[model samples]
Target: MYQYDAYDQQLVDERVAQFRDQTRRFLAGELPEDEFRALRLRNGLYVQRFAPMLRVAIPYGLIAAKQMRMLAHIARRYDKGYGHFTTRQNIQYNWPKLEEVPDILADLASVQMHAIQTSGNCIRNVTSDHLAGVARDELLDPRPYCELTRQWSTFHPEFNWLPRKFKIAFSASQSDRAAVRVHDIGVQIVRNETGELGYRIYVGGGLGRMPMIGPLIKPFLPELDLLSYLEAVLRVYNRLGRRDNIHRARIKILVKDIKPEKFAELVEAEWAQLREGELKLRHADIEAMRQRFDQFTYDPAAAQDRSYAKHLEQDSAFASFAKRNVLAHRVDGYAVLFVSLKSPSGVPGDISAEQMEVVADLAERYSFGEVRATHDQNLVLADVQHKDLYTVWKTLREHELATPNIGLLTDMICCPGLDFCSLANASSISVAQDINDRFDALDHLHDIGELKLKMSGCMNGCGHHTVGHIGILGVDKHGEEWYQVTLGGSAGNDASLGDRTGPSFSRADIAEAVERIIDVYLEARDSEEESFLACYRRIGMAPFKARLYAEEAVEAA
Candidate 1:
């Protein structure tokens, strides 16, 4: 809902022009492959297994209806009629031609969007709670701060090329929907005892080779010093983070090696110099940034709808959809609807151009022309009136967007694994599809209840496998694709890395293994309310491990 001003427009236009020239040179053989690699990566273009993949950043996961339409247009014109939404709340085109990427970037620039910093050593997209302003239990809107951080880090001279890529996430709600704990920097908006707004800062949290839940570096940092404190933290990492080995280059590795206390000390020492610097966020600038976001206008008469209640009573399918897909909104008589991309047979996050246009139309008609992308790779219509919920559901169902499986096992977060990613050792999309097909029973999934299943093709943890209730990592074993499973991992406020199960399962047995793990959970759980993660935490890996290994032992015998 933040409109780009003339300055913002100018910056994006200039970058498009610059990248256009760079791309032309690279294609002309004037630029070396190594040099072009860095340039193209900075522009969010990756050469995949089959073709180039272009990742476009959706800052704070917010997109106007017009932007959505433009994205749909891009998909139709440039891509193969579809694009994939990613765990970072970005969109990706899997088969983009290198020569046409500049044209795509120009098209994106026209809509106040770009692929800049979506993939690079510089700070990536600044993500936040998808339900930022509209969540019923939100403490404060985190987007304003995310936007501020985006501006601060976009082309910051000191952090242009850090030792490794950086990510920052903000969550103001009690629920950690943004998975801030696994980010390079995690920001939690808080109010002090004196009722002044501030932040609880956590530094050096990340996944990949070393998964870590960032420690609380500063329990309370003043709101005015947000940027300065961030500068302090980044400065410490930028100077001290490892450059000798790419594997040990991330801030998390540095933090883990040096210890959180020492890292905190260093950050504090750096902050002491910048606490009063010009980088300090002033109230006036904050207010000006906040003004860019448009306030929603809710209808006073939309308190209740008898027809909606009737539909819920009569239609079991619609009832399930309404219950799972519709979330409570802060505004009275309104709801936030999750448009699930995880259809039973479809790819987890892939949306066709037609679906994009449908979502755009739905947003324009029902949600004030605004749409949001979630960290879980789903689209959200954040301002649907309760009265129109049934109509919205009908439209979504017609387009296969109403899956009614928001937090279920089928609603998984998966990466473009071996199918597209050249770096991948195994196929994440195939594994996800296999699991989805195996768990196609709606009643069974509902009975299993709120599960966060995540998968990655490799250890880069793009799908955030480290934090899923059920984490699956694809591995290469003797030229065969194998999967290693982990249990009890979570990305919430109480974040913890999952412990791996016994042995890797062959590609064929992976889905069955997942089913067995779920069966173990179902039988071991005290009640239906006990989720897979909670059950695993309560019983430990002994029971599940016994079940899986025993089955494997019997099969081997």
Candidate 2:
């Protein structure tokens, strides 16, 4: 985790004080509601259904144990006793009082955290792979680049107000765990044929009402030009992006209308002017940022431990948790442990204050005091010793954080829909709960195998429903909540928007509809080795749709 330098600290402190004054003015009626709304949104405060929601950024999804403790303190003192982790690697406090939000910002600032750039149609949080440096197949750690970009974009004078909210993601892993392909700007760190590092830039990728994968704008851009090239891209978007219509104001829409090739050409022309300018990345700066990430210390002796293998054979429950939650680390003796916030006992991403403290303690004890938040609303203890796996699992189990359902049907990506969001047409939390209860049998979930089920209350796609293997979108039909299902969507390297399965199902039948679709996959799958996405890709959605609509007809008759 990169500790804040003096510059970073000063910026956050100033922003907090500025917002505190703005909040005071608004509360005193010196500022109108409309004027205050924009100011509040710029600071990550939103007026939701019942109360204000505050989104705090976890840059590159990296947080130290101390920062986690601070978040727990904020949740306990300010809002309700919990916070919802989001798909963008941020956390939201849904019930914070409007007047006290400035104090909450102050609390976050003490821990080197802030809400700036987390909201308000500017460059949002810069997310990266949770595993970053620890992943076995990572080409390079993307955190330094992410950090540099975050600093460059924070309150950038030229891009302070873009046409719409923009998102950026970086992924260096062989597997695209960061969902890079679906972001506004997805950068893949790659090596050229000459063995020089560079980036493969994808522009115009986004998922909402109009879902599309960003096309490759630059096949390979030199590493030295990372910042300059990014500036060019933003410059082009800011100049030409639409402001007439809110729905079509995103960079994706601009790219779609003008075509990606033209967009790239415009960016390239802009880069020609700014390539070696002040924003050009320097080697010393890169190295300094990289040095901050080199904190992991592994014990070579743990590599020789045979106890982990023995324990796996001896304990089925522990083995299940290990198989599902434990991930391969680059070091021989180390492991990356994913803590599931999607336990069936609670909402998909809500972590209680107590759980936050427990996670912080576990990270300090077993993972070198570091934790990473995932894009799927999970948490990662990225550096655990292999020999200590059983003990870590036991601790997580006691805290209800070890759910042994990673990549399975029960581990769903959902949004706080109509229950909390004013933009929602239906309730996503209830749908997720129903699906979890219906698939509570661990054996059944394991059999389902690698299903990415996501749901959203409305078309805003906060739940990322467009990218799920079985995407469920809630729609309002004459004041009735009906769920629409999509299949064959994936957020990985082969990112594709899901296709609609059939007509929408009633709220009562949504879970059963999901079960029927799963049953169809089970029957049609070539083998257990075939995942839900793989099988759907092989057979298409016709079989699932036929089965689902057939059930609908039977009920109608």
Candidate 3:
């Protein structure tokens, strides 16, 4: 994790003081609502349906154990007893009072965290692979670059108010776990034939009313030119992107209207001027940033524990947890353990204050005092020792954090829908609950295998439904709640948007429709090993659509 220097600390402290005064003025009627709106948004505060929501940035999804404890404290003291972890790897407080937000920001600042640039039409949090430094197939660690980008973009005067919100993600592994293809800018760290590291930059990728997989703009951007190239892309979009219509304001829209080739040409022309400018990364600076991250000390005897093998053989429950929640780490004796927030008892990403504290304790005790928030709304203890698996599993199970449903049907990515978001059309949390009840059987979910079900309350695509194997979008039709389903979408290296399954389903029928879709997949699959996504891709949408609408077709007849 990158520790803040005096300048960073001073900047945040000054911002906190500035926002506190601004907030006081707004309440005192000295600041106009319109003016305050921009100021509050820049600080990551949003007025929701019932209360104010505060989104705190967890840069590149990395948080120290102490920061996690601060988050728990904030949840307990300022907002509701729980907070929601978002798809962007940030945390959201749904019930924070308007007057107390400055206090929250101050509390966050104490831990070197803040809500700056988390919202508004600016470059939001710079995200990366949750498995960044620890993935076996990684070509380079993307966190240093992510941190560099974050430092460069925070409060950049040129991009402070873009046409629309901008997002950037980085991935270094062979597998694109960061979902880089769906970001406004996606940087894939790659090594060329000469073994020199650089980036494969993709531009114009986004999901909303118009979903797109970003096209490759620069197949090989030099290591030193990252910031310069990004500036060029932003400059092009900031100049030509639509300002008249919010719907058409995103860079994706501009890229679409102009064609990707033209967009690339414009970016290239801009880069030709700025490539060797002040934004160019120096080798010394890069090395210094890399050295800031603390390395973990792994136990040499971790892999030699016979008790771990015995526990796996003796306890079926522990074995199942180890099988589902544990992922292979780059280190020989370490594993990445997922703390599932998707327990059937509550909302997908919502974690209670006590639960947060538990995770912090576990992270400190087992994973080198570090925690990672995943884009899929899960917490990861990225460096747990192999020998401590059973103890960690037991502790997590006791706290309802060991769901053993990672990448399963029940382990879904969902947004705070009508329940919290004023822009939502229907209730995402309730829909998720309904689906969880329907597919409560772990054995059944395991049989279905590796399904990514993402649900969004509206077309904002906050839940990333377009990229799920099964995408559910909530819609309002004549004041009634309905859901539109899509199939075969993926956020992987081979990213693609899903195809809609004909008509929308009533709230009552949505879960059943999902069940019917799953039934069709199970019956049609060549073998148990074939995933739902694989089967859907092989047979196409015809079969799933037919199954989903078969009853409606009969009723119509």
Q: Which candidate is the best by lDDT?
A: 3
For every candidate, C-alpha RMSD to the true structure in Å: 1.2, 1.2, 1.2
**Per-residue C-alpha lDDT of model 1 across residues 1-557, encoded as one tens digit per residue:** 88899999999999999999998898899999999999899999998989999999999999999999999999999989999999899999998888999999999999899999988789999999999999988997989999999999998999999999999999999998998888999999999899999999988788887899998889999899999999999999999988999999999999999999999999999999999889987899999999999987789877765777888999999999988899888987888999999998789999999999999999999999999999899999999988888999999999999999999999999998999999998999888888988899999999999999999999998999998999999999889998888998989988999999867888888898889889999999999888888889999999988888786432311
Per-residue alpha-carbon lDDT of model 3 for 1-557, expressed as tens digits? Answer: 78899999999999999999999999999999999999999999999999999999999999999999999999999987989999999999999999999999999999999999999999999999999899999987899999999999999999998999999999999999999989999999998989888999999999989999999989999999999999999999999999999998999899999999999999999999999889989999899999888876778888776787899999999888888899898888788999999999989999999999999999989998999999999999999888888899999999999999999999999999999999999989999999999999999988998999999999998999999999999999889889999998999998999999878988888888888988999999999999998898899988887777777532210
* Candidate 1: 10-residue stretch with minimal lDDT: 548-557
Q: What is the lDDT of residue 169 in candidate 2?
A: 96
User: What is the Å distance of residue 66 in model 2 from its true position?
Assistant: 0.7
lDDT of 2 by residue, 296-412 (tens): 667889789888999999999998998899988899978889999989988999999999999999899998898999988899998899888899899889989999988889889
Q: Model 1 segments beyond 4 Å from truth? A: 553-557
Quote the positional error of residue 318 for candidate 1 in Å: 0.5
The TM-score values for the models, in the order shown, are 0.98, 0.98, 0.99
**Candidate 3: clashing residue pairs, number:** 0
lDDT of all predictions: 0.91, 0.91, 0.93
